[model samples]
Target: MTTSVIAATALDPRTMAAKGAIELRQVRKTYGDVVAVDGLDLSIKPGEFVTLLGPSGSGKTTTMMMVAGFEDHTSGSVLIDGRPVDSLPPRERNLGVVFQNYALFPHMSARENVEFALRMRKVPKAESRERAEAALDRVGLAGLGGRRPRQLSGGQQQRVALARALVFNPAALLLDEPMAALDKRLREHMQEEIKTLQKSLGISVLFVTHDQDEAMAMSDRIVVMKDGRIMQSGPPEEVYNYPLTDWVASFLGDTNLIPATVLERDGNLAVVDLGSLGVGRVRDRGAQGEKYAVSIRPEHLKFRTAPVAENGGTGELTSSTNLGATIRHRLSVGGHDLQLRELSSDAEAPGRRAAGPVHVGWDADKAQLLVLEG
Candidate 1:
């Protein structure tokens, strides 16, 4: 492989002690006629924990492997600290990679496994042992260093693999579904640990995962990908609360989508007619059109036991489910289906007494209007 170094600007003082920033420009990977990544552009600031999240067959994992030098890109560039390294070998790139499965050697003890990298790099025997012990201790396996991989539990083995990754102190750490194997409870605990470790060490982390909640909980920023392309990239709150498109809105969480149109605009609010619900006013900002989809979260709807005439809208209880603190009910409103989640102690389902029709209404500001995409 051939590599050429280009001059890069000096690092900022705040980011001087941490790993370098990474940049990918128009990066594409193709196998025969199939394209895994299509003109992907991403920038990761120094010491940032960025997650690449998407469904199966999205290009998240492929992009990460290219950064680790494990897979070659069909075109474009991969730069570290502003220096292009598309042609460099994996070892020369100074990257630490953690796979989903624990890739520890069966014959080597935990301490020996962590020490192997240092030994291969020609560190003195005494120095190797000291570094290995320190790494094991850092991962909470100080006393279990003598045990082999088979003797340790799955979580313990993962910790050993983590220790091994940190032993060499690479410039950046690449994790591919690192928490996929562990049970739900243990996975939560490890997520916190991993975030804390990344912050403390100030290492640049590129994490890939298919789990939406896990990505939202652990990452500082998320890059949502679909069909071999990036759909959106931003802070977790921004991506969750202010989605750029309707596809993003529906994928992130449970929402009640209602068909509506813009009635009129005044100041920052626009009044909308919610069909059979009522001629209720809604906030549409400035959009006015014939067809639109209004999105409201299920938890935002308010249900009441009053008559349909007394309440603002008409609703009929179609189904009910008990979810501990709240009772979830699916109400059919004319042609649309709305989900109402209410505190059980606050109000019971309106159908118990044979009430012919119940009612529910939502605040105008709680609605989001999604226009037809081009």
Candidate 2:
């Protein structure tokens, strides 16, 4: 299928507002005795696509609600373009919100629904109609504006909801799992579309999702939250490659966490003792401690015929699973189970199996040394 390019002129000038720069300072939300958000501090630049990523009950949604003016924050301030809007209502905040359910009016046609926000703002009928059609066209739903929510497919309905959000030209867009209802393929397609559209229109977006892959794919910067506080925040690649905590390392992607004791440190490199396995060097960023955990991505582990170097460790290949593009192997090393992933093309033939003794190794530079935390 051919993908259509979104034009710069897709957004109507009258409706389009300047991109928003959002800042949340010491934001905290408490529900009686329980705190949902704790001293959260975040800043999103104008036209930047930032994602709040975490597991359920991590306060991602609550932070978005406070920014959208849907839920009142207990303290701190939410500033859009450097103006505090803590007491402002949702409508007056000029922030577009798209929920997981799409939240479309069942009885209203697509065009009408897209124009509803304009109507509430007292826009003239003729102008509202023109802007609504333009918004629908921008989202590739031009000719289907007359269809109601039930008449459109799930993806189409989602497009209509997005059109409605864009019709008013919000200063910023807040999306809370908008593609959660779609299938995997459709969700991926929508993710690309949203990213393209946001870049073309130069609108700030605060996207909230629990899907790590989706967040990594769409975000310019990712803020990882846990227990109502930020565990780490940085560019997608930086956060994934250098996680500050074990939780962030484990949550962002699959990893092998090996317990080790730091023997010595030399600049950015640290020599660590992996009990019963062997000694290895890893990238350590000034961590002064005896106990540490080494994080290594499964893909980095290479299966060797025998111990190759200082980084090599002997293990028993317990099992292997064929996953089409990749082969996943389970190995037992030093009484701990570790996973090793290799490209299918690089793996042995499907009929051939290597059991018993095996060697696993990774580059010292690729391994991350993290301080063990409670």
Candidate 3:
């Protein structure tokens, strides 16, 4: 049986009345002298899905906790719909939170677990029951409401947790690595489900995760953090394709960073000398200097039939690895090692391995000039 893809559709404006915009102005969180989050200024428009992405101790989770009112910020304010919510309790703020561990009550049935939030809000018992069932249905657990947490699968228990979070019609949702506990395939499936639910409900969401692929898949915008500070924030394509810093470039994915000297600048492009490899033009962001690093994604480099004009280089294939859909090749060019990825369908004539003299080149436009970092 073929599974049909679910496309996220825009919700009606009336249905999204409870959606709230969140803004953090100069938000700072510190434990003694060590800062957890430093002067974070972020704005999440109503119905927007924004992700805080970083490695451990990068302040992504600390920032989320501050927004959820579970942790206090050292300075600054958190505003929801232009109103300050820094002093409000988590329940009073009407924010839904789902943690990495699906914190469902093991003793309670799925429906009761979902209904607990509504009961806390003083919702009528009858109405709470109705809402709980509806929430379960929304999460594809319609008939599983009678099951306990242990009786359900990991993904199902997570759905119950999600149902509990959404049963009260929250203004915004806070997800802290919600898929981290699941296996790889289930994690990917749940990512799509959460994204679909967020979009369908037109609710603003602040998702926190260290997985770059998860952030890229589910977020409308991604905020990359490091050492309690934001390294970069932008649409996934923008942040991935045009990172603002060397750290951002290196952290996001695999890329070949080659040190080169700037030869000339023309408009938005700069000609850089890659020493023995030759000269190439790359996108320049007003970086002034003779020395810079050119970041080129592995997929951008290819085996050229002949020497191209400005961006061609001679390299020897030093290593090759098969990665199912693609072949990863490490090339030694002018004393610098560069990684190249070729489609598996376009594998070299030698079947498994292709290690020998290879003409490696990439289009000048595919490279970006970055300032050398310490």
Maximum-lDDT candidate: 2
Better of 1 and 3 by TM-score: 3
Q: Candidate 2: which stretches are off by over 4 Å?
A: 1-8, 12-18, 288-291, 351-353
Q: lDDT of each structure?
A: 0.77, 0.87, 0.85
Q: Which residue pairs in candidate 3 have backbone atoms (N, alpha carbon, C) closer than 3 angstroms, thus clashing?
A: none
Q: 15, model 3: CA deviation in Å?
A: 4.4
What lDDT does candidate 1 reach at residue 173?
Answer: 79
Per residue, candidate 2 scores C-alpha lDDT tens digits across 1-374 of: 22564443657433343657899999999999999999999999988899999999999999999999989999999998899998899999988899989999999999999999899889999999999888888787879989999999888888888888887878889999999999998888888998988887888899999999999999999999998999999999999999876778999999999998888888889898888768899998775554679999899888877776577688788888989899899889778899999998999876444646788898988899986768
lDDT of 2 at 128: 96
Error of 2 at 188 (Å): 0.9
What are the models' TM-scores?
0.84, 0.96, 0.94
User: What is the TM-score of candidate 2?
Assistant: 0.96
Q: Please name the candidate that would achieve the greatest TM-score relative to the true structure.
A: 2
TM-score for predicted model 3 compared with the true structure: 0.94
lDDT of 2: 0.87
